[model samples]
Target: MISVVILGAGNVATHLFRGFSLAENVSVTQWYSRNLTTVEQYKNEVDITDDLSDLKVADVYIIAVSDDAVAKLSSKLEFENRMVVHTSGSVGIYDLDKKHNRGVFYPLQSFTKGAAMDFANVPICIETVDKKSYPLLKTLAKNLGSPVQKVNSDQRRVLHLAAVFVNNFTNQLYRIGHEITESEGAEFDMLKPLIVETAKKIEDLSPYRAQTGPAKRHDKKTIKKHLKQLDDNNHHKAVYELLTKSIQKTHGRKKL
Candidate 1:
């Protein structure tokens, strides 16, 4: 059985705990959090503790903390030479303290508390200095129903950048869509199907080929109409104009 100790009390940590719980061959030895109130409720379910000195001996230590706190937490760990990995796509794998065997276990998906995660489609990006440890990570990913990907620090960094565009920035655009619909006294839920279909299109066609709408067509009249609609909202207007110009440039229609 692969034993693990998870460090952190946030969304990623909670989700990882649940994922590991489903693995029959996996045993979560302990969970560490600086704040008691955050992880206190989990005491009955698992060995949850606040003291770093009280960490359990486990095969793997997964630091599911923020990118900034990863190094600090790793440094605080009293254990050394144990397989330690941080759950971050942007941060370098070597960011963790050098005392332990450092690695990366990045789940390439946005997580929300209370939301169900089917890791079947999730890409688990992993990296390690030792080749022998690769199988352990691969097994963990398979147990979690995620596809394993061997990604180095630099590749993971750029993958994170693309993820930010596809996930974070896309969510912001959804927020903008929500705002625009609300302004027109329309329900935001109405756009849900459109969003789903737009995402599904990439499975069969390239984003460039699947592209549509005013900007892609260079329909200046429709673009002007959209600009006019957003006239009262300068922030939206600026964003729309910038993206339209970018799309036009991408499709070789940048002359205008």
Candidate 2:
């Protein structure tokens, strides 16, 4: 079995702990958090500690902390020359302290505390400096039924950027849609099916081909109406105008 020690108490760390705990081929040897109260509940299931000096030997040490804390935490580890990996999308593998073998086990998905997550559906992007560590990481990912993809630092950074557009930015757009619907006393729930279908469309068609709506069709009248509807909310107006112009530009149409 692949043994692991997970560090941090954030959303990503929590989800990773849940995924690992359910994996028959994986054993969570220990869990560490600077704030003992955050992970204290799991003490009965696995060793939980706030002291780095109290850490036990494990096949892998996963630093699932924030990006800014990764380096400092790695530097603080009392052991060296062992496989250590971080769960970060944008941080490079070299960000880890040079004392140990460095790698990344980035699960490319938006994580929220207490949200249900199936690692089987999450794509795990991995990068490793030590060749020997790749297979181990890959096996760990597969054990959770995740699709493993080998990506370098640059590729991972680009993926993270695209992810922000698809996940974060898209969610913001949904919030705008919610506000707009609520303004008219319309239920945002009505748009659920459309959102599901829009997502499913890309499964077979490329985003370019799946594109639809006024911006893609260059329906100036409809576009102008949308901008007018957002006139009361300048913040939402600017977002709408910017996205409309972007879609037009992508389709080789003149700026709206």
Candidate 3:
């Protein structure tokens, strides 16, 4: 069995703890948080501690904390030469202290506290400086039904950047849409089907091929109408104009 210790009390840590607990070949032996109250609920299931020195021996110690804290926390670990990994996408593997085997177990998905997700569909991007530590991490991921990708630090950094565009920026766009609908007293819920269909289209078609709507088609009438509808000097108007221009440029349409 692969024994694992998870350190952190945030979204990633919560999801990993649940995933590991259900994996047939993995055992989550300990959970750590600087504040005991954050992880107090799990005390009945596993060893919980606020002190780094009290951690027990384990096959893998996962530092699933914030990016800034990963290095500092890893440096504080009482053990040495053991397999230790962090769940950050942008943070470099070398950021961990040199006292132990350093690797990354970055799960490339946006996590919200208490939101339901299936690990089987979440791809895990992993990297390790030591070749021997790779198999253990891969096996642990496989047991959670996660597809594994071996990526170097540079590649992982790029993936995280792209993720911000697709997930974070796209969500912000959704918020803008909500505000627009609210201003017109239109039901924002009516756009739900379009949103789902747009997402599903990318599954079988490249984003370029899936492109449609007024901007993609360079319909100046519709574009002008949209610009006029948005309030002057508003941030939403600026975003609409920028995206319209971007889409037009992408499709070889001249400025509208």
Candidate 4:
């Protein structure tokens, strides 16, 4: 069995801790968090320590801390060439330094604290310093029911940026849609079917090809009506106009 130690008590840490606990041949032997109070709920299940020096011996130390804290926390750990990995999408493997067998085990999905995660569906991006640690990271990812891919640091950075655009920005758009409906005294639930269908269509079709509605069709009348419906919020108005212009430009149409 592979003994693992996890760092942090935030969203990624919580998801990984629970997911790893469910995997066979893997035991989360220790958990390290600077905040003693935050580690209370998990202390009974595993060895929890606020002091980095007191960290228990484990085969792998998975650092699930924030991107900024990675280098600092890693510098404090005295693990002697042990397998150390971080669960960050944007941060590269080199950020962990060369004092240990470092790698990255980035899960390409948004994680929320206290939310149940479907590990089998999340794609895991793996990277290592050299060949020796590559297979180990790959095996661990497979045990988590994730499809693993070998990616370089530069490529991973690009993927991370693309993920922000696709996931984070798209979610923001949904939030705007929800707010718009709420302000108009319309149920946000009404957009559920349309949202699901839009996502499903994109699975098989390029977003550009799957484009519909006023902007795609250059329906000037509908576009004007929608813009008129916007309140005095300049930010919302600018967003709508910018997106509509982008869609039209992509489809080879003149600005309305």
Q: In model 2, how large is the Cα lDDT of residue 37?
A: 98
Please give the CA lDDT of all the candidate structures: 0.91, 0.94, 0.93, 0.87
Worst ten-residue run, lDDT, model 3? 225-234
Q: How many clashes in each candidate?
A: 0, 0, 0, 0
TM-score of each: 0.98, 0.98, 0.97, 0.96
Candidate 3 lDDT, 167-223, residue by residue in tens: 999999999989888887999999999999999999999999999999998888988
lDDT of model 3 at residue 169?
98
> What digit string (tens of lDDT, one per residue) describes model 2 on residues 142-255?
988999999999999999999999999999989989999999899999999999999999999999999999999999899888888878999998998888888888999876
lDDT score, candidate 4, position 133? 85
Better of 2 and 4 by lDDT: 2
Clashing pairs in 1: none
Top lDDT prediction, candidate number = 2
lDDT of 1 by residue, 1-256 (tens): 9999999989999999998999888889999989989988888989999999999999899999888999988999988899999999887877789999888999999999889988897899999988898899889888898999998889999999999999999999999999999987999998999999999999999999999988889899999999999999999999999999989998977832
Candidate 4: tens digits of C-alpha lDDT, residues 1-256: 7788999999988888888889997889998888978889877898888988888888889999889999888888877789999988788788896898898988888999867899997888888886888887788888888899898888888988998988899999999998888887999998999989998998899987898888889999999888888856777888999999998899987697
Q: Which is the better candidate, 2 or 4, if ranked by TM-score?
A: 2
lDDT of 2 at 182: 95
Q: Which segments of model 2 are wrong by more than 4 Å? A: none
